[model samples]
Target: MAADGLDEIDYGILHLLQQNARSTTPVDMAEQLPVTDTTIRNRIDRLEEEGVIEGYVPIVNYEKAGFPIRLQFSCTAPTKKRHQVAGQALELPHVVKVDEMLSARENVQVLAVAKTTEEVNEITAGLDDLPLTIERESLLREERRRPFGHFGQHVVDD
Candidate 1:
């Protein structure tokens, strides 16, 4: 839905950052892209302004950062009330994020982080009596996303 000449450059930057988000700096990217530093800065600014690039978030080793186990709940709420229930479910303090996905090929899941089993239960408890039905509750001890370095190793690495 969005168009930009610098899309590939943006993707290249993101690809490099996927392995280590802090790996490259703007100046380095400017040099690598062979574009003026101002151009690089302006491109990043434009991406941010359009919300194409959200705020940079550090991927804390949540497991190492005191939350060893995480809970992911797959929910199936009534079609009409999905929005309302999703709002309430995500409002719980321990609830980190809630995703409402559609389509037959897709799956719905809620990821919650907790320091202990009690915290996980507390989060789940808060979801009780919601419009959604709990289809599955999967607990993952260690989880990670396969880094999608689309541009591969050509991008600079820190």
Candidate 2:
């Protein structure tokens, strides 16, 4: 509703959608958020147009889907080849997410899931072969991840 940034209603709509994007409709959000359905629809369209709402994705249980090993890799590359190396990592098997970091030491963060440690090693080996990759530090994820939420905690209702 504001020219510069999101307001209370916008944040509330986002919160409800984040909780359950697939089932949450504008009508349902309007009932819970004290806004009209038309308002909700407008806000959502604005959010999408502004790229705030990128896209929706289904949450998968990787462990139950036969991929239990979760690995995190922090990698660094030369400034010239940083983007090239990161793009190459995305094409590797089991690579789920690849993020570019601002830090000087490690500029790339990769999240991968595999069915076994062997698969993790294979993925790492493929990454290591890339040119300009200076260093890589990996860790196995142990804790169970909770569902995505908590974004609304910082939003104040008007």
Each candidate's lDDT (Cα)?
Answer: 0.69, 0.77
Q: Which regions of candidate 2 deviate over 4 angstroms? A: 1-3, 132-139, 143-158
Cα lDDT tens digits for candidate 2, 77-155: 7767778888988888888888877666688888889987789789878888876353655566564654446545345
Where in model 1 is the C-alpha error above 4 Å? 1-6, 104-107, 151-158
| TM-score against truth, every candidate | 0.78, 0.80
| Count of steric clashes across candidates, in order | 1, 0
The candidate that wins on TM-score is 2
Put down candidate 1 lDDT per residue, 29-49, tens digits, no spaces: 766664666876787788788
**Residue-level error in angstroms, candidate 2, position 76:** 0.8
